[model samples]
Target: MLAPTHYPLEYHDLRLVLALVRGGSLAKAADLLGQDVSTVFRAIQRLEKALGTRLFDKPRSGYSPTPLAEALAAQAQQAEQALARARQHTLGGEQVQGCVRLTCSEAVLQALVAPALGAVLEALPGVELRLHGGPGFANLSRHEADIAVRLCQQPPQHLVGRPLATVPFVLCAHPRLLQGDGGGAPPWIALEEGPGEDPTGDWRRQHFPAARIAHSAHGLHGVAQLARAGLGRALLPRWLIEAPLQVLDEPTVACASTLWLLMRPDCRHIPAVAKVFEGLARHFTTAANH
Candidate 1:
């Protein structure tokens, strides 16, 4: 018999075993965990050796958990729950502490979420906020981030998501461009295909289907700059465009986008994640209504 501590299985090993059981195959488990098959196999071997029991048996259909493995899985699940509880207690129940990974767009990070989250950080000194800002959405289902702020037409079904607010977009032109002119010809430079798509380059096709682009960029900052330089009218989030840029008073051209907060259903209950979500919701709701 192997001693419990001799070939000890770490928390990750236990998690890998659980993933394998749930996924039903080495390759499937690896895919789920974002790991290679060899890594999953190694973890399983380590876990089985530690317990001196064969946890899984190969079958025609796929790998099946043995009776001993099933029993061990039940125990492991209980242990995992206990550990999670202990972690919560150690941090302070219902009070957020520790690090939280957040994903958002550059404009939101610089203009809204970052500033609002600064208040949260000040309130909770022990908490760490890891912000990832860019165009693409992070994979929350795989634990890529603990919380996400996304602007999307529809939220994914597997995760818990809430509407933060509906942010309005405005068509703005540089003061010089609109000085005595009628905002130039048609075809304004704009954000390419919504927030989920790339926000750079010549995106006139989507916003100004009939207009030609004088310049293009991959970020809002660049587009805003070009518009300010009288390159062309640009579509941008109202929050990101500061004073001096004149909003084109065309009711037919304006559009609104929905902002959403998303989190894995499992992590939604985490105090840290919950606190941030509440704070963001409150801030955005108040801003939008005002």
Candidate 2:
């Protein structure tokens, strides 16, 4: 058997192939790439001819990549990243100034992200920062966020997650709640009912296992509000409610939560994102230790 004649594939052809693989159909890929369907189809055909193999098999569901195409897709992804870095370098290295979108929990935003924003802005005046605060994890692999702060025991695989700090938990209450209570230690207000016994109520059980909860809340913020209202004592992150509430020494529990900064391995080479990552790492590392 003779080996097929190999024709070098251009970057455009590689991009078209990758788009088709991702979009699942020629028409969809065309829409994403802003090209006519015929043009996309022609590009795929040319790619197949050059490689001497069929790249896609059309099915009732959608276009599915063949084994060879699947293998090529991985290579194409790396090539695309390399090309982006090359373009950035060619742009005189000054173009690293731009907006970076970050996602993290509300507590993280308050404790770490908000404090570091000033330094980052001063260093890169052309760069802007947009923060997305929530609990659910953002998909960094898909570029949903340029960076993320999360609490986890293990960092995600294929992504760089550096340990920034270990946040400790503390039991606190409003001053008004403790006025009538004795210094010896008052009865506590629990957050939830109990764990395993009720999945929806486990959050309460986990945080306030000893206290008798005066009010039940669905989220930590609501629970914090209830605590402030003197409803009951609650366990909360020290960094979040430290300044606002009176820390109860008697019921104080030293539970720890790990803080991590997550980013794609490939993104570390992007100058703007890289600089932000470095800044965050330095800021959090120092903050965590202190």
Candidate 3:
């Protein structure tokens, strides 16, 4: 009883073997490999010697692959396909056929950006859009996202984009939320904190100094949700106010927040990024800059 020996196989050798099997003759295999017939013959002999077995039967008509050779040829085909798949993945980002991650606040994504997604997809056929909605910002310098949509008066100096929308804040409450609360600013549901003089604390104080505070929430959506649940009146952005939650009064804070489309300098030239960015700007630029 004896054990068959194992041989270390090279990728180049497997290629030649597959070529020989598929081409059915040494001359054709050499042509496939861009080598002379003698070189192909010598390489096949070396492979056979390494395996301690004859791979082909050299009949007068042509070469016939043995059982071992057939198995090895299948392995070669599998290797070819595997390499092809890997190549596709490697080349994925070299073109515009991959995904683009977009980060923004949950409120904005819901109110304005989310609805316009259909148009974004229609324009960029193969580009995938990954939307992440949260409070804290995604770092563009680290490539956390391809783009960011947010409400800011002064966007970070490192990022770049024009103002998308000049969203205004209005007092809104659910129809049954505070019907008979007896006016005097409808009791306030305010944001916990935000940028200078207004957005949360100052705006509430300056506008309705004598009004009572009903509830306070961390994020813009949370503040709106509090109002939606029949809690109290909330000062909210125009985009975030939906049905049932009717405006208690006209917008008092014009340009309370400006929607800015920010992106890293590196991604500015990418076709998908540039195209989507312009599309978003156009979609947001309407007659509603109040």
Candidate 4:
């Protein structure tokens, strides 16, 4: 097999391939690449013609990448990372005027980061913070995100950052639902099973063996909303505690999860990334105090 570099492929072509491989669908790839689905489809067609082989198998669910496509995506990711590092080093000392992409869960964005945005912008007038909210962590090594705020027991060792807050789990529900001891297997609001391991779900199952799951949501944000609606009791981070939802002290929930602010080692020196990093760290740290 000819090496991917041996083929007549442009840098952008490789990026499209990488986006497709990561996204698993034409619409998702287009969204990541900031292109239309038709454009991505046309480009893939052209790329396949140039390479003289099929790169993906189109299935009902999503795009299944061929081995060659996977190899090309790997090379593209490495090249993107190298280019980002080179660019950061070359312009590390320049004014912090470029965009800094920050990725975190929707819950964090709504409860924490979003509230701090105006202050952050006021402090760094020249910088633009692009917020990407999702359940999955963006690949920092691939330059998918400049910074990430994650809620986990321990962040990946490769990333560089500190835990901003120790987030404990809590069982909460609408005030009306918790009129009494709130016992007897009350309805539960559960997080739907996904790609990663879920300790909270396991805790719920182990603790509440006969509990009925009345509602299911993708993440804590949705679970909280469901709890607020008096649908069921939800196990959420202590940070998410708010009005209409009161904590249930009897069935004590405990998980030593921490909120971490992380970034790539190569990004530490970039003025915009550095400034945003410091600002976010301070914001979350101060909030954690109260």
Q: Which candidate achieves the best lDDT against the true structure?
A: 4
* Segments in model 1 whose C-alpha atoms lie over 4 Å from true places: 1-8, 14-82, 91-93, 179-187, 193-208, 213-215, 252-254, 288-290
Q: Tens digit of lDDT per residue, candidate 3, span 227-267? A: 88878888887667877799865547543767788886756
RMSD of each: 7.6, 7.3, 18.6, 4.4
lDDT: worst 10-residue window of model 1: 197-206
lDDT of 2 by residue, 46-150 (tens): 777777778889998878888777667677768866765676678775565655668876656776688887886677765667677764444576445678877
- Candidate 4 C-alpha lDDT tens digits along 92-130: 664456578888888988877788777767887778777
TM-score of each: 0.66, 0.61, 0.57, 0.72
lDDT of candidates 1 onward, in order: 0.69, 0.67, 0.73, 0.78
> Clashing pairs in model 1?
187-211, 200-217, 200-218, 201-217, 201-218
Best by TM-score: 4
Rank candidates by lDDT, best first.
Answer: 4, 3, 1, 2
Task: Output the worst ten-in-a-row residue range by lDDT, candidate 4.
Answer: 194-203
Candidate 3 clashing pairs, residues 3+ apart or interchain: none
Work out candidate 3's RMSD over C-alphas.
Answer: 18.6
**Candidate 3 structure lDDT:** 0.73
**Error of model 2, residue 232, in angstroms:** 3.2
